[model samples]
Target chain A: MSLLEVKNLCVSFSAKGKEFAVLDNVELSVEQGSIMGIAGVSGAGKTTLLRTLNLLQRPASGKIAFDGVDIMSVSQEELRVLRRRIGVIFQSYNLFRNKTVARNIAFPVIIEGVNKKKALEKAREIAEELELIHRLGSYPSQLSGGEQQRVSIARALITNPRMILLDEPTSALDPFLTSRILRLVKRVNSVHGVTVIIVTHDMSVIKRVCDQIAYLEKGKMVFCGPTHDYFSEYYLSVSHDDHAAEQLEKAKKILAENGGNKLVRLVFWGEAAGEPILWKCSKGLDVSVNILYGEIEEFKHGPFGTLLVATCGKDSAEFLRRLSGNVYKMEVLT
Target chain B: MISELTRATLESLYMIFASGLLSILLGMPLGIILYTCAGSKRLASVYRVMDVSVNIFRSVPFIILILLLIPVTRRVTGTIIGPNAAIFNLTVAAVPFFGRLTENALNTLPRGVSDSAQAMGVTYRQFVFMVLVPETLPDHILNASVLLINLVTYTAIAGAVGAGGLGQLAINYGYYRFQWNVVLYSVIILVLISQGIQLLGTSLSRMLRK
Candidate 1:
């Protein structure tokens, strides 16, 4: 069973007695010990979806099952245990302004009746792993933005939760700090084998740290798949037209230069994706193929590529027809 | 004359501190309830009642409130005239005033502070004591200072009901007997007390700021 399964979840807010759906018919499943990113533009309900999983924003209707137990039907005591098991980090970092870094991290542990001294020790250990040991005595306001975010991460981890939900963890950080935070998230997943569900508007964040991807749009789950598939498919599905158009323009220019040539765009996934497919396909086509545009992206699973190939004095339709059997997407542009 | 001045000054302090502390203890919770009820979807009716009631009670003149609480004051303290009675009336009047101020202070907290606390899986009770109260503590201190400064004026007015304080001494020796020295000394002492409270409160608020 998946570690967390949200099936057909719906949530609404009633303002002035009119109900507005915030999360509509959202379904998602996250496995144990995997890092998944939920990507969307603002108002897409990504954060709301994460909140629903934690049951913070109680969904109007849905069944969220964690470890085969329906979270919606759990008793209050069981719900508390469920909440403790699923940690959430907000964009603001939310370190209690008055408490020192160690105490802020120690708070949830102490609430569960751990000895304050032992809790602080546990906090220091996590802070050390996150490279925040030196700032343990500092208050939240005293830390820089990046340091504060690490402290927030430590506070979330101190509970030893099975899953952690991060909502725009790097939105307020600089580029260098953003990379550091992403690396920390990756390390936490690899080292601890903990499940992490991150909500972010930044595609770079998803590409950097997430093994799986969930795309939310207008309160709907538009796409969910492995990271490699997302990398190849995301650009095609979205309006990041410049990146796609740049390659297409190069292919077009080559096709124009090589009079009567065709532009064949190929997308490959899994073991089927790599350098050898280009060689074999060209050799099979019996025509000298000029590589117009080429790029390969490495995702969590493996490698994927979107290649724009062209041929002189020949149409590439026959070549593409054959290539379609092996690759995920193949299109002939003339 | 010196002894009399000292006694009036002490009486004023007694009334302000005793009633101020009691008012805070009672009013802060009242303010919390009002805030929680106002924010929660299920507590709309409770919020409406409390909101309107606070507004109404706040609008009542302090002198009228003092007179209105007289019977209960006498019942509680077993005396209708003295510092004890003044304290009782002062406390009852201050509860809604300070409650409103506490509510305002809590309202000034950024929404994210509360949202993050709820996301942390804190129970409602824990959210109040641990997060809500402390998150708004700096503002609460400032608000308390304003309330206390305002209450100093209220206490002097309580002297109208034979509550012994500088106001009574000024009325007896300065106004009725026309002794300008008694009036001037009392006014100067009151000014010092007000300044001391204002300065100490402002600095304390500044020191604890996040």
Candidate 2:
């Protein structure tokens, strides 16, 4: 079973005595030991979904099952216990102002019944891993924002949770710092075999670390699939840009001149864009491969995008069949 | 005369500390509870009740509040005309006042602090004791100082109602007997004590901040 399964979750908030739904009928499945990205614009309920995984935000109606156990049905006592197994790092990096860095990192462990000495020792180890050992004695107020965020991440890891939910972990960070934290998160997931669900607005962050991506829009999961598919799918779903439209117009004119039933448009959704598959095939065969419009973009998983091309002549059908191996879809636009 | 003035000052100090300690012990939690329940639908009724209750207690003038508590004071302390009785009366008036003050200070904490505490998996009770209280320590100290200084004023008024302290000395010798020098000394001592508490609170708050 997946580590986390959210089925038809819904959350509502009453503002000025008017009830409004923030999340509506959202379903998601997170596999064990996999890094998943939750990406969306503001007000899309990305943070709400992450909170539901830890049962921090209760959905009005839905089933959130962690490790095949129904979290929504658990008693308050059980829920507290369940919460310890799922760690959460908030966007605000809320460090207890009265605590030193070491104590802040040890807080979760101490609360879990570990003695203070052992908790602090464990905190030292995690801080070392996060390169924050030197700041152990400093209070959060004394540290820079990046250092405070490091303490927060170290605190989340000290408990050895099964899954960790990060809400915009690097939203306020610079690009360089953002990548560094993303790499750290990737390392934590891979090294600990822990499932991770990150809520972020940065596509580059998702591409850099996430294997699967869920995109939310207006409190709905508009798309959820492999990271590679998200790249191609997102591009496909956007209204056709002027360049692509203009390329299609030219392709239609060329197709009319070619005067054949075999004229076709080809689109590739993977790294095949960097290859010369079309040039190789049409060169040997009696085929003409006219590149109508082609674009390639590097994505998290690998290179992902679509290329548009037109082909015609006797070997066009066979060429199209051979080319289908590299492309996600091949459409005959005559 | 010096010994008598010294004893009156000590009596005022005793009343302020006792009532201040009791008020903080009782009211800080009450305030935190009110803060935790702020805007929560489940605790809306409790919050409103406590809000109104605090407002009512705060509305009563200190002298009248002390008189109103005489019967209860007699039951608790078996007397109502000494510094000890003034402590009880002062605490009774101070609890709701300081409770509201504590609530307001806690409300000024960063919004994310509480959410992060809960997300960290601490229980509601733990959140208050460990996260909420510690995070707002500076604000709490300042609130306590304000409450204590107010208690100083209240204790002086309590002294006028047969509760022996600076107020009683100031009234018996200064007002009733027309000894203007005694009134001047009492005012000076009260002002000095209030300034001392405020200074300590300010330095402690600044030190605790970073």
Please name the candidate that would achieve the greatest lDDT relative to the true structure: 2
- Kindly list the per-residue Cα lDDT of model 2 for residues B1-30, writing each as its tens digit: 789899999998998999999999999988
Query: For every model in order, what is the number of clashing pairs?
Result: 0, 1
Docking class of 2: medium
Which candidate leads in TM-score? 1
lDDT of each: 0.83, 0.84
| Model 2 bad stretches (over 4 Å) | A238-274, A290-294, A310-315, A331-334
Give the lDDT of residue A290 in candidate 2.
Answer: 66
Q: For each model, chain A TM-score? A: 0.90, 0.88
Q: Write the per-residue lDDT of candidate 1 for residues B50-109, one digit (tens) a residue.
A: 999888888899889878887898789998788889989888888988898888888976
* Each candidate's DockQ: 0.59, 0.67
All candidates: TM-score: 0.93, 0.92
Give the per-residue lDDT of model 2 (tens digit) for A1-334. 5898888889998899999998889888888998999998998999888877776677889888899999888887787788888878889888888899998999998877899999999999999999999999999888988898899889888889999889899889998899899889989998998899999998888888998999898898888878877765544533425755666677678767866445454545446766777776666677777665666666555675566666667887778778776576655655
i-RMS of candidate 1:
1.7
Report, in order, each candidate's fnat: 0.50, 0.59
